[model samples]
Target: MRCRASARVDVSEACNLLCVDETQSEHRFEEALLRSLHQGVGRKPRFFAVGAAEESFDERWLLQVLTVAQQGDMASVEFLVRSRVNKTMQRSIRFLIRGAVGRFGGRFTL
Candidate 1:
């Protein structure tokens, strides 16, 4: 079964923050954030990636690559590569190229 990012509210208001230093590392902030959220709560609430649930990263990427190919837009194609899609998408990319080839009957080179 496919898993999704769990739903959660921003816990920033539920407690008092003692530290707000600009020098804090991102990983440190993440650790602190998770700890604070789980602590002092009445129950153990499910936690998710801080931004994963809010971001439509995967769907946006799929649309981007496919749109680029569909329009034969070279810039969007390059943008999709720079978007940091994972290797698993390579199979989908190959499938898309094959489809384009089949659809256009070799008249267009992807």
Candidate 2:
């Protein structure tokens, strides 16, 4: 299963359906760590470099990474994590992240 935007995994196919928050369903965010554990699946993460484009600051990319992780796309999240993209241009989102986002708040630039 590929997690990138229109990013397709090399696998032949993905399961028809997915279950969430169950013993059967392992969170993709967590799963990505597990996948990273193996020398094969857990290599250095790759992320798309974002320049100072006005439109590139959309939270959609971050949200998409989270959503894809929720859907068990470790590679996608890894790409983001490794790439370290930032979207703090939206001040409101920064406050929200500081207020409540991720296990803990993240880095921000003024």
Candidate 3:
């Protein structure tokens, strides 16, 4: 089942971020974001590097990565990498790269 952005109002409120109005494009964007994090559908060189290093995929790592990716704040990302999540440099770098890719799309050549 699909979740509405309205349904996540508390989440936005907690994060002090403005809630985007529900629209087809917004829904599509959210879905794409989900797919990229959950299924690795999008091209992310950093994520690829992390995947290469790990024997098994980590959902928690992916979620944290998604959070950083969505926020697009380098200082916050750096803080998250250092303090919050238990990840290697490879994984942290990948998360940073993935966040950048999410914010600014281009040929993620690496």
Candidate 4:
């Protein structure tokens, strides 16, 4: 999830499983997303000065948040909208506002 190597490994494993059985592609894709979402703890703050903050470039949490919105979770949807206007990291804020929304293909709306 953090890098191409790990993502490749995950996809390879999922492909192996599918080849051994007859799992649907969508199911396998969702399983892969869930597996990645629940991986190790996200980055914690590394303070260098007062009020300094650490930004999480992790996309798994991003997908999880967006997925929640896509599933009709009001609170999470509100959070995404709020985050779009806040001082969130560029990576996450862009995804929150535009990128991931488009990826959701109208399944989720702000």
| TM-score, every prediction | 0.31, 0.27, 0.28, 0.27
lDDT of each: 0.39, 0.34, 0.38, 0.39
Between prediction 1 and prediction 2, the one with superior lDDT is 1
- Residue-wise lDDT of candidate 2 within 1-110, one digit each (tens)? 24333333221122112222223323332233222222222233344445533433224554555565445555665565444423322222222222222223222221
Number of clashes recorded per candidate: 0, 1, 0, 0
- What value does the lDDT take at residue 35 in candidate 1? 42
- Model 4: per-residue lDDT, tens digit, 5-76? 234223234334532222333434343433333221223212133234653444435555667756657477
User: What's the lDDT of the predicted structure labeled candidate 2?
Assistant: 0.34
Q: Worst lDDT window (10 residues) for model 2?
A: 10-19
Better candidate number, 1 or 4, judged by TM-score = 1
Order the numbered candidates by TM-score, best leading: 1, 3, 2, 4
Lowest summed lDDT over 10 consecutive residues: which window, candidate 4? 38-47
TM-score of 3: 0.28
Q: Lowest summed-lDDT stretch of 10 residues in model 1?
A: 1-10
lDDT of 4 at 12: 31
Native-to-model Cα distance after best TM-score fit, residue 50 in candidate 1, in Å: 24
Off by over 4 Å in 4: 1-57, 79-99, 102-105, 108-110
